[model samples]
Target: MSEMYKKEVPLYGDLIDLVSDVNTETLAQQPEIRQQLEHSGELTRLNMERHGAIRLGTAAELSMMRRLFAVMGMHPVGYYDLAPAGVPVHSTAFRAIETESLNRSPFRVFTSLLRLDLIADEQLRQEARAALDQRQIFTDNVIDLIERFEQQGGLTKDESQQFVKEALETFRWHDNTPVSKTLYQSLLAQHGLIADVVGFKGPHINHLTPRTLDIDTVQARMQGKGIAPKAIIEGPPKRDCPILLRQTSFKALEEAVSFQNAEGGYDTGHHSARFGEIEQRGVALTPKGRALYDKLLNQAREQLGGTPNEHNAAKYYQLLDSAFEAFPDDYQTLHDEGLAYFYYRAVDDGVDMSTAISDLDTSASQTETAKQAIADLIEQGAVRIDPIVYEDFLPVSAAGIFQSNLHDEKQSDYQGPSNQQEFEQALGAAVYDELALYQRLQSQSLELCLLALDSKA
Candidate 1:
């Protein structure tokens, strides 16, 4: 059954609270919970150390992820895709979490998965399609568990414990199938995993992205380590601006995966599907703030092409600042003007500034106050450029990482243009309200991680 149909998954924190009231003090005494949280923390650290590169090959892979993390008391809240860029195939989905609490730990990995079967070509596409068509992504059992929890509002203490164990055990299953040399390549040709049930091998920790205060440093460091980082470190170019997300990666390592070949044989060989990806996440944007940010990006990209060199980054910022001067910032301006979807604040100074300004030559003076505010902030180091987080993945970058690690880009013999909507519809997912999704996940993550970390002490 689809996740949507299975049952309503409670928002992350509610699910946790339902299981048990994890207050700051109570969590500290729970050793098991503490251990699981530490494990999560370790995963975050690992992602930063190596870069984030995890593969989610199937529905079971996805389900196992939700379950395994739930063992650590996590939940799936948002869905994202990068295929909308519409070029070389790069469709990955993720759930963002606040890795640490403002009062607690650091931020967690904004994890992504490789959409292998969504290739744009034919030969390998068939193989990928065949693999997915033949298998089930989520099991009835997994659905049942989630359903029960959602309905009951919480699992009994014993049940929650068992759920965690089963969740972990499910993902822990590995490809250990024994096979002969002749059959090895055959099975490898047919499937990517040693186990045929899930079709592809079980999911591995693909990438563990760490929150970098300075992505340029990490990018340079990765380069020093011989990893050719991503071409563009996404986000604002200004050093002082708050960068949302800047990511880079070394080449994907040729990690050995259990591959079953034809003639019912198995062999261990390396595949380059997984790569190290690192990111620097910035402040969560309010809905209004996000609109302004996106508009700024669009304006920037239109003025500056794909690879925004240093010169281009500077140029783009200048253009944005100019546009912003003539425009009211964000949805707030839209609301104030009776233009947008969200609410706004109205400041009644008890004086009609419009009437006061109606007589004087105010054209030149109109933007003076706003400009001064920006200048003041900048002068005081209060206003920083909002770094463009890697909100959308670059097709070349995605394909570049895949190509460096894959056998081939699979000879793009695409018959038609890619349809993002069709793909998302099949998954029964909607284009997420980015602002709302980010807030919900971050708030819950802060609550959960803080509680978990506190307990560890």
Candidate 2:
């Protein structure tokens, strides 16, 4: 997929190189961070990380997408509603669930289904549906492979390679428009996203993102390397201990396309939809921490009075920093206060048995003593706490990235409702609750650490 994307978008290869250089420099400068990533099994997967985004035109496409990703050991992890953020789609990130699978290859796809109901023009909505219905995104061979995998419970090595080849065609860019230019324009008038979904032959992978240790560095260096990055990065401001996902991207490419004309001929035009993106993930937040994050984010946005852009990005970031000062910055504080999730590991400190036993003596109850012992071990550097990497997307941040890549004037006026139920119905399965996943990971780690501490006692 990376090779296909690099071939299609030449700049993407450059972006990949830039991110690789930045990661190398980051690791050299921050050996502690490198050690943390290596200890957590993240360093190996750092360069292997790639998450692509695609807009689906129908429920069938999304349902089929779920089956397709399953062949690669990817599952839909979380639900994201972009309607509230002004993009007319709800999404789920399809990626590997198991840590081992993730370490092998953490390729994810941010798949979104177009919300046709958001189109205010009744005629345009129907026309868009008609346009979408006439096109098929997946190749016949890929569908056959998906069905075979379902029957056999897996694909053979040869079949797997063939399946990948066939699946790549689905995301490959097609220059020919499925709909006529007039119909494309009509749908474009409704929304640029709508046109991108319904006008094209297929939902080409819009952007392929590479994970970076420092997105600010990449964003700052993009221009020097002849790559134009977006004006502002999306998500939380830079922090000592980053929380959740921070993203930045280069502008979408304007590529030539042939639009069908009424006279049975084609006319040349351009479309801007695909781009290069970079991300830096932080610890997954608990529900309480997420609520606070949302509250502070809303406060900052309300104060700014508009979407973050060049004009107010500095002031917005300042306000965001001030608002988030209330949130804890240290990993220990975040974990202790139950604001964030972390994986706890028992470390052999080589301390004397007498010292370990002496630290356990307390006036508290038996359970309290155990808790205190564990806390003391952590404080005394006998236990290590690693923040669980956030494996989900932020709706607002996703929408912000979408909006920035799209044409500035092409704003949607559709103030419609969000229907997660409808999205699930279309998906043919319920989306996983990301918070629950994080909670389970955190709880399991703590339980293991407690058991280790009990044995020590």
Top candidate when judged by lDDT against the true structure: 2
Per residue, candidate 1 scores C-alpha lDDT tens digits across 178-285 of 333344444345333211222453444434343444456665555444455544555534333242444555454454556566756567754444444555443444
77: Cα error in model 2, Å: 1.4
Model 2, C-alpha of 247: deviation from truth (Å): 0.7
What is each predicted model's overall lDDT from 0 to 1?
A: 0.41, 0.85
Candidate 2, backbone clash total: 0
lDDT of 2 by residue, 144-237 (tens): 9999999999999999999999999999999999778888888766667888999898989999999999999999999999999888788888
Candidate 1: C-alpha RMSD to true structure equals 13.6
Error of 1 at 271 (Å): 0.4
Q: Give me candidate 2's TM-score against the actual structure.
A: 0.94
